[model samples]
Target: MTRYKMEEVLPLLEERVRRYTHNESTSVTYEKARQLMESLLYCLEEGENGNGMDIMAGEGDVKTAFTLGLARKKEKIKLAEELFEKIRKDFHSYHNHGYEETVMKGMPAFFLRYDIEFDGKNHLLTLDYPLFLEIEELTGIDLIYAYLKAARIEQDFLKHFPTLSVEEILRGFNGKYEEAYFNISEIVLYKALGCIMVKRPAGGLFMTEEDIMMLSKQLQERSKEELESKLQDALLSLDKELHLQSEVSEYFMTGLPKIVSNFLYYKKIKKVFLLFPKRKQKMKLQQKFQDGRVMEDEALRILIEKMQACESLEDRLYMVKENVRSLRDLKEILKECFWGDEFIQVFSLLSQEEVMVLKKEMKGRIAFGKGCIYKYLIKI
Candidate 1:
């Protein structure tokens, strides 16, 4: 016999049932259908052998019970079909709106397909055991009971696989499986919303430019602290209502990236300030650029010239370094006007090639010392 306990097997069964019933067409008689589904779910929850048959009955008797249970389930399904048809007819005019469409069409079909794919596959395969365990704990049911019960019939199979090893389980059986299912459905919903927002009239999901501008202005008027407070309150409300984590890191790492990328375009920050450096050490080279010791006129001109020539933020930073290296080489001739440490610090952040370019520019500037600084810098 497999060492796998009833607690271990229960969650798989519950998840299967959850998926199966997710988008099930609930009727005007949904209460009746829900009860029937619950009873089936309850059987899985209480354990298939909850009637004390596992202990009291022989192996042959257990098989008989299993066979009978399956028969009884089929009859219940037939009754459910009848009731579903009635409900469908009654609610014939009821269109599946945003929420209903997601639950009914997306989740239900996905579950049915999942169960079918999983039926003959080995039970031990799992993508993430922890996530599966979490789902099991939440639902309070076994997910693999049906397959396990079937596996029990073959003594050799049971002997060979006495226990369901977490590693042996298919990864698809875990909650990650459900996450993928939900993610796909969410993508579809987002696309639909996008269509409404872009193609539909202002009265529909889309609003006029004036309305958008007004909303933007209103939001801008709010103090940063007030906005942050409101955002926190909104997240807390969502956490309570949805029973999910509301942390920024979790949101950014998981579903948020996909959602945000779909709707908004973001600019990359070229210059990054290390707010939290691991170590703080002052370099000796920084002393040279301190004050009015070096001529600011030529240095300023070189910096501005390079900045203007570069098309992008990255290019501009590159030019800063090129100017620095050239100045470093002419250290002998321009000892009185040696490049300062402040300039070096800024240059260090740039690429090596940019440093080379700066070196060349500095050499030219020093050689032609009489050039108009403001005009040359502005032209660059």
Candidate 2:
């Protein structure tokens, strides 16, 4: 941009405009021409940034600069294509629609129809799908190349595990995750860290609110550097257990801070209370934790019925916090709760005597679908 004056490039730009319009037009809107100029400079910037070259450092004009840039762009595209081949060889979509669309649809379009010559600045695709750590500062081919590089690393990391384990975790992470964009690697890493934080097996079991609380406490106790170090340790442990390649293990550090930040945000939102989330579905089941106490408050009774329809712990907790008023409400909710720990959250809400009273009151036989809860409660 600094090397050539608009006046100096005007005739060259007019020639390009004429060529693009098939010699039928010699003029365009100033903004369009400016964008075309950026297209020209985009190539030069690509050359300089990507290949460590200074195309405009000397007496090079826009054409020469653009020539060098186009060469770099083509090289990047070729490398991206190769990376795409690597990705396609053993990639699992995890049943995620966004990942499928971005890889199967968006990437192919970019490779097939990108106008590297006349429209290098044109960012043709809406990369609605995001990586664990997204590329935000770059656009067009720069974004594509960077994204491919990150995705290659993610593919390398994720493919180390059994595809079934991955599928299970992704489904467990969000049953509705596929409807929109999500970071596949982030979700997997989240599951891994959640287990690590609680001394459970990494990459198994859905993390509950209690696990989130423990994760937040562990992270919040540390200095910024310590938090980074802790997550790095967790990621490295997973890497060692999974036998990830050395460089791949190293690359995981970039995602730790983002995860830590996300966990801390949950604390700012005050994540108190628990709702035992055993599984997804509806079935005829007896209710315990009630001990023959009828819910006489009609509005409260209606709200409890509404609670039965909520599927996730987060949703149930929000509903309970916003609607349920007292310990009686919690006890009533517990009659429908399927399991406990959320590891010690339900108990944290009660005193020693109240807990003893509730423990004695919940002594009835288990509901048909509430075995996990019965097993968990008797242990208390």
Candidate 3:
């Protein structure tokens, strides 16, 4: 969060690199060192201001900080040498206990440091300026080259398994499939089976003829329990997937009732009230009153009356203030009734005069020919 200027930091970076070069006995002197230092200084300054460098810095450990400072100067030769030594130590520890040892690779180390891909083309690696700018400050080499090398490895792997798709990546193998070395092909087939199982209803638990044929073909090389186990796994997965879909639909349904209530209240429109039946008797009651249609005003009046007659203190107060035309007049009346604290807490949004007028109006049923104010207020 602290702001730093590149102009201010660049001199500091140059001084530090010079000091490091003088203190450390290394034959890695070059003109590119200053450029690398500047690049790192730029990345750190930009990252600090833009909030992007923390990913590279991680938790600011001593090793990472040292690495970052060296990387800014583009001292790839030295950085690579250091990384190779660390990897060698790791491999040695594992091999000393009679474990099979594979040589500690330079490309993996480079990728872990810079998070870049390397293709076969060396030029492609060197030309990656963004990678250099972002990672050079924290690493010792040009990450662009390492990234290109990693990309080459990925490409080579993909070429061997040409039919791999994203769907195959999601279906992980259970214990049984582990023995077969379940590759991308089996993973894709399992995903297809899962999709088919999800399409079937709960009661229709039996596999379809097409699914059975496909399953039989896929499992022709495996045991019956493996196929059954996969089917069981698919069914369990479908249970959670289907429930999520249902919950999403239910969330949309909740909004519909609120929408219907608001439209009726604001637009002065009469509409049928949709009620959920709690029991079979309630369904019969709904059936008996299927033809009944309540006017909007009449329904509001009944609701208001029910609220007034209710024994609940909260319900009575909510009904009175929520329906009031003037909240100021209502507040004064609440004060007279020793309900000032509740009035201020609940109706802070309304003026005191408006609350007073609302209270006075509620006392009498003011008739105005066919259009009565009190009757309309009660209806509301």
TM-score, per-candidate, Cα-based: 0.20, 0.65, 0.22
In terms of lDDT, which candidate is strongest? 2
The reply for model 2, stretches above 4 Å from the true place, is 48-59, 200-226, 270-380
Per-residue alpha-carbon lDDT of candidate 3 for residues 111-182, written as tens digits (9 for 90 to 100)? 355421111112212332111112232332444334333323222222221121221121122222222222
Write the candidate numbers in order of decreasing lDDT.
2, 3, 1
lDDT for model 1, on a 0 to 1 scale? Answer: 0.32
Q: Is candidate 2 or candidate 3 better by lDDT?
A: 2
RMSD of each: 23.4, 11.7, 26.7
Q: Where does candidate 1 stray beyond 4 Å?
A: 1-52, 55-63, 90-380
Candidate that would win on TM-score: 2
Give lDDT tens digits, candidate 2, residues 298-355. 8777877787777555456556535544556666676675245441234433344555
Model 2 Cα displacement at 28 (Å)?
Answer: 2.9
1 versus 3: better TM-score goes to: 3
| lDDT scores of the candidates, listed in order | 0.32, 0.63, 0.35
| Shift in Å, residue 263, candidate 3 | 41
